[model samples]
Target chain A: MLSQTRYRMLYLIGLGLGDAEDVTCKGLKIIKNAKRVYLEAYTSILTVGKEALEEFYGRSVILADRDMVEQHSDVILEDAEKEDIAFLVVGDPFGATTHSDLVLRAAERNIKYRVVHNASIMNAVGCCGLQLYNFGETVSIVFWTETWRPNSFYDKISQNRKHKLHTLCLLDIKVKEQTIENMMRGRPIYEPPRFMTVSQAASQLLEIVEDQKDSDKESLAYTAETICVGLARVGTDSQVIKVATLKQMTSLDLGRPLHSFIITGHLHPLEVDMLRQFTDDQSILA
Target chain B: MLSQTRYRMLYLIGLGLGDAEDVTCKGLKIIKNAKRVYLEAYTSILTVGKEALEEFYGRSVILADRDMVEQHSDVILEDAEKEDIAFLVVGDPFGATTHSDLVLRAAERNIKYRVVHNASIMNAVGCCGLQLYNFGETVSIVFWTETWRPNSFYDKISQNRKHKLHTLCLLDIKVKEQTIENMMRGRPIYEPPRFMTVSQAASQLLEIVEDQKDSDKESLAYTAETICVGLARVGTDSQVIKVATLKQMTSLDLGRPLHSFIITGHLHPLEVDMLRQFTDDQSILA
Candidate 1:
């Protein structure tokens, strides 16, 4: 019972949102000692590059794309039979929700694994002074096209409003997403990855509201005058957060990829006090 | 422009869910260099005592009770004008949601502060194998009394169920709470701290249904047969998780103060597969 089992172990470590310093001390120690380290590159993007992480940890990190992680994961789990292999993720190891798949596969194979946890945007959004508990279901806003545009996220936002709960909209990120025609031809042709900014997200949201307007009494969900908060590069020193009306969000520039938008619900006095700090016009609340 | 403002700094550090090792490297570095460190003691509980943390950090930590933190915080924020001071929190600094108050105060007073993030139970609940994104609003289940049993959380769970989302129920903890009569006497007659357990939570939930029953099938939203997962001491080496029917949970014992439970709505195949590992007989599905 003492030492009989194989030492094959996998460490899925979370490098918190901003930079390399965001990685937890326990995670960093393991990264320095592990035989191999893999940085998950598809779900979310870290503001810094792999070189930055390598310089900080004093080790070379292999980048694991979606294909490698979803398809060829056997290679990553193989050598773990004798040593620890660390798979680093940009936020909490469970941040992207899909990370659970990796944990499942590892568990299916009986490979010992431990998750090193860190801050994810889901929790860090509290920086905006919104109570995390007050938020309802979180929805992702995806990029739209001529014929494939979808507005299902609007319904979730509406339902959250009915419950008087805030809604956190996670903007879609397309990394290594293949074009439809290229996929049909079995070619590797890929479109440059696109990140949906808060401005674009607001426009799409408004478009849906416009489409659904029969007499335009504001849909009882959200309107051009409803309050929305836009955040970009959260957790970074240069992070930006601003509050504005839905119409104003279309023209505001918070900057950068990985933008998040929130539609607020009934406001508590403290929440109002906090949001006042980020509102464009101080007279709105005064 | 840079040298004009005072250099007073306050660091609100997150000591992750478990014991001392859960503190992030950035947080630990700040703790080591700070002149005084305060551990917030009321909002949540750490599995370990202050001495354990002090021993691990090679420094002394002052326990900041609710009164000290909420009313007498000026004492903790005092020395920061001339030296660095760290305020440590039991989960992510924002996990309690109320920490934002301190941040607002610091900002209002022109006291520069930074938050060193770590894992909170909200994200760490992903270990139960539910897709974290599918989770709806988190609700707190407080201890009930003869005339004070609140049914608000029931409605929230119902709303989440209607949306086909999982609900993370954060059981309440009573730390340093005093009796109303004793409080009026101007004496701090502290009641021994109480932590709500999964069994007690389940019973109180069922009682609510029984009271509302005219000819009830499952008016409480969750029935005796509803699927429930209970977790104790999450993120620690001795963490325990078990799955059972709501009826079965009333008798099951998962030890320790920090416990969490999930009331599932629609279950994905992956979720069912993952939860199967924790079921006692493995015949719940078969």
Candidate 2:
């Protein structure tokens, strides 16, 4: 029902976590008829690449990297003044705060825009059989550096545990980030993007737990034997989910980047019923 | 590509919070090709109903009430054993744990199923410009009764506030709930479904705070002057968001049901930038 009479529009489309087919029909319709499509590839990624998306959507999508989106967004908006342009974001359009900035810019420019929502891990983690309502604060697990190791996120998890609520830990992804020195020298050199694996996150989490004492003053909030769930590439056919001890999680093969971890607390019986199937207690691998 | 072998399938499709168009293209395609589609009406509702969904989807949808789903689910899955069936869930399929039980049922019946994810209130609250990641445990504000005024959910919000994390209060919806006498009499009489408005929620919240005081004689958790956000009919064209004090919020008119409130703790500069626009500071009524 879209009119042929073109109106200048900027569509922020959510390409769900899976392949192109995962894009909603309405979102795909807008993409198919879009003047241009830019895939915001920084915050997260799809299981498939641009080629697969192009083949499925039948439109060549331009990759809008961090620099393009954060520094040169005017360029992304330039075409919006003339024709309908699409900014396809992985997961929900507002999953990343940056997208909201884009919407603000469009509003300032008097360019009309619309956001088409899709599933984000913030909600999709319910697939792990954890009660979505039981989840407390969601915290990010960032990659640790030798001198820059920070354990603040673990405190958030501790707070959730205090309330007997589940905690969803979003692993970090550093994409197209410039080296500090390189940035200072006005150089365009960038480090290869790094994504935290579930194993790495588990190891770092254990380290933090070792440092923070628990209520007993002898143990920590989470230990090696604590039950945890590691999810990799959710929303894909090859999606992996494992319920194991924190120690076992370090050895599990989740198969890809874009991983998430869950530190569970008290669970309802129904939850226990659904989650027991994935628990390491029932597996020889433990 | 789906194989055209005409296999019996149970598709747990997510009809996004909006109308029929909110159903993903993938979901719509399955609905079009399926032999039956049942809309689960108890958990939540879309902006449009069966008639509008039928008009937009070009297919008739059977209304699956709570009784049919909880007691007589076999009736829903009966057709699935012979042909493709669609069980349309509002928002994401796994948003409610009850739907997970449905998956368990489908598995028990040896029925194959797939969950097509869509935007749920869990993630759609991002529209209010609050960083979804920064939100802590979500709480539900239920209708208070003379003898059954349990305020346990308030404690959860208090815990989240202790961590300086935002709390998303999911206003309660009572659908087809029967009175104790009617249920005991085996009568079909039921109380009309009730959705707690933001105003009602704020007033109750303030009363609880007045009753629960901290060790130092200070009011626990939130006060009447505490800032809060009220969102009504989210994901619809008429979605309204207002920011005001808890006392100020108790009188604001946000129109119909399906309202959610945010008990904000700490505000990031960017979140403040976006939310300030909705703040009552600029209101002439204030």
Candidate 3:
């Protein structure tokens, strides 16, 4: 049972993508009652602006940038021993591994904490008609360098395909990233990072498959003709889910900064039925 | 742009697992404005009692059972064409594949629809520290019968293992189920069915693994000592997540009707850290 004591702190609140109104009722109650509310902004972005959240909740939200939470967590933990403080996150609190560290810290400090859950993109991708349980080991595809191109994600995708399970590829988002020059000069120089788009990811994946074939690592590897799904702005009013071949998706224009790709392995009848509605051409499924 | 006139016909609203207040702000507005509201009671259950929802919403909710939805969808769809009808589903409207069919039907009839999303157990399972994208092919484990035991789930688990991705097993729910006698006699007879418990599922999985090993089909297989996570009443206030060996979890009582399991495959450093907090023995990872 949760104590009614006002000194208790709640950490890691998942604000479902979209708007402040997306917060669960339990999350809202915690935010309203907390002595201070901090939004962790570096990890992910909410579709709606923070001011919109302030107007809806009628409370000023403190921004908890990466530096404050990562480098200076003591500030948030100081009054948490006596006064209630809440750390907000987009999506489910534990969706990212970093927040789990905060929970462990709270446990070590003997400060009781509660997690307010919300919708996450993890399962939201099921809206495209894939079974949530059938997705195998999700891998992230990061931007490749001219000299340092990694192919571990290719191996992971190959493994998923062997089992005939869906592969959910989380596009990389680089925020507050430091450049090599900044590290060398001991200066806090930051470079504007990029979020990988679905089209770019699909093209890269095709290239990796072709590379494997050329190296004789695997025969009959996936190609641009492979069926895939491109999703943009998931969990929002303007959310779009489209089904296309890898070749088709490579050129398909899906507006937005955050995008994800689904490389399907096997399809159950029900899943195929669901995907059919989202596709413009049925030949892609073939 | 969504047409205002379309808003009058069909509204697909998500009722979060807890109570009526768990519905998003947009959902509440649609529900209040709806001339009639139907609660989908088949796919999932809410933690809060129905009475609590009625008290909070100040409206009586018409329950829509499986029969009503499958056999009498016209009742809901017919009214939607003439009045503002709201269909309330636990979790996001698209969480279940069946709901998408309903929306497609409404679309075929030229009934404009809007879906308001909410947190569902699909992503809620990420609270266990497993990457949402890392999960492969979610499968349902049904209660076994003496002569009709099925071990097809083993294939899916093996597939996940091959890819080193976590597998989320959604235990079978037997709500409003019929008995074998009713089918043979062509009578309206029903028997109270059972919800699969974590212990039962683990026991059956062990049996399958042993059987497969005996047949030499798979020399190596998961056993009672396999690491697993048992979750009960996910998305509820009393939700419990516990990590233990399959042998230990089989005898551990979770104190709930709805239970799910996560069979760990490969663990990342961060995943190991997160699981440490919930494991029965912290040194298991070592």
Candidate 1 residue A141 Cα shift, in angstroms, is: 0.4
All candidates: DockQ: 0.52, 0.53, 0.51
Return the candidate ranking by TM-score, descending: 1, 3, 2
lDDT of 2: 0.81
lDDT of 3 by residue, A54-78 (tens): 8887899988888888777777777
Runs in model 2 with CA error above 4 Å? A1-9, A79-83, A96-98, A110-112, A178-192, A210-219, A283-286, B1-8, B79-83, B96-98, B179-185, B210-218, B283-286
lDDT of 1 by residue, A80-149 (tens): 8678899999888876454767777888888888777888888888878788898888989988988889
Between candidates 2 and 3, name the one with more favorable TM-score.
Answer: 3
lDDT of 2 by residue, B44-149 (tens): 8776779999998898999999889988889888867778899999889886434877777877888877667787888888877789878888888888998899
Residue pairs that clash (backbone atoms under 3 angstroms), model 2: A25-B25
The local distance difference test score of each candidate is 0.83, 0.81, 0.76
lDDT of 2 by residue, A176-200 (tens): 8888899999998989979898999
TM-scores of the models, in the given order?
0.94, 0.90, 0.91
TM-score of chain B of each: 0.94, 0.92, 0.91
Instruction: After the best TM-score superposition of candidate 2, give how far the Cα of residue B235 lies from its true spot, in angstroms.
Output: 1.6
CA displacement after TM-score superposition, residue B53 of candidate 3 (Å): 1.7
iRMS, model 2 (angstroms): 1.9
- What TM-score does candidate 1 reach? 0.94
Error of 1 at B195 (Å): 1.0
